[model samples]
Target: MGRGGPREIVQLTGDRDAISSVTFLADGKTLASGGGGMVWLWDVSYLVKPLSFLCAQVGRSFTQEEWERYVPEGPAYRKIC
Candidate 1:
């Protein structure tokens, strides 16, 4: 939303973190995740492009034009930055 809610969509799965439970909150925008003695709350909202989100977390931002140079065009991929 324009008000600035969660701005990213992240995929978390049992194969990755061993999630034991999942449920949506009554508001419908929030999700609860549980696994390994931890509970995580997530809010769904408009998301930035994947590359842009990564760049921001590391203290920078990239436009789509900039991202094209570093990302491959197809299934070929690189795992580390």
Candidate 2:
């Protein structure tokens, strides 16, 4: 049903108000969120495989130099994709 990993079902923008509530449907994959006097639904079944989702969005993994900037004292960068 999906490529796997976590995939963003939708991106909400232009709403100045904060979210008021949220509920997950019985199926577990459907989610409902309310805000700004409106309700939005999302399908979250793709979250089972987060790596695939991230790889698909970025098309490439982080480079050593870039990773070092965030984890300067951590282990060497390893490509995830």
Candidate 3:
């Protein structure tokens, strides 16, 4: 998180999982998390827009091999990469 600034309004949590890696979009409204074999996308402006939300999954089930190479543990409260 940016902390104590205009961009500090948003915060992210891994819950019980370990955070591996985090990526922010160019617009700063979107964020991506990767860890425990799963990927998540979040909208930071959820308060103003009900549609804004966070989405998560347990690894990339579509590409088993690629998911294994990227995230081998499955989903976690926090990212590990």
Top lDDT hit: 2
Residue 9 in candidate 2, Cα distance off native in Å: 14
Judged by whole-model lDDT over C-alpha atoms, candidate 3 comes out at 0.54
Give per-residue CA lDDT, model 2, range 16-72, as digits (tens): 375788898888877788887788787776665644565677799867777677445
TM-score to true structure, per model:
0.37, 0.44, 0.37
- Residue-wise lDDT of candidate 3 within 1-81, one digit each (tens)? 243335433576664374588888777768888888888888865634321222223332335455466444434233322
Q: List model 1 lDDT by residue over 1-81, tens digit each.
A: 543455433575444465788888787767788888888877653232454455556565444555566543422443323
lDDT of 3 at 81: 26
Model 2 sits at a Cα RMSD from the real structure of 9.0
Model 2 steric clash pairs: 4-49, 5-49, 5-50, 6-49, 6-50
Off by over 4 Å in 2: 1-18, 26-29, 35-37, 43-47, 68-77
Instruction: Please give the clash total of every predicted structure, in order.
Output: 0, 5, 12
- C-alpha lDDT of residue 66 in model 1: 50
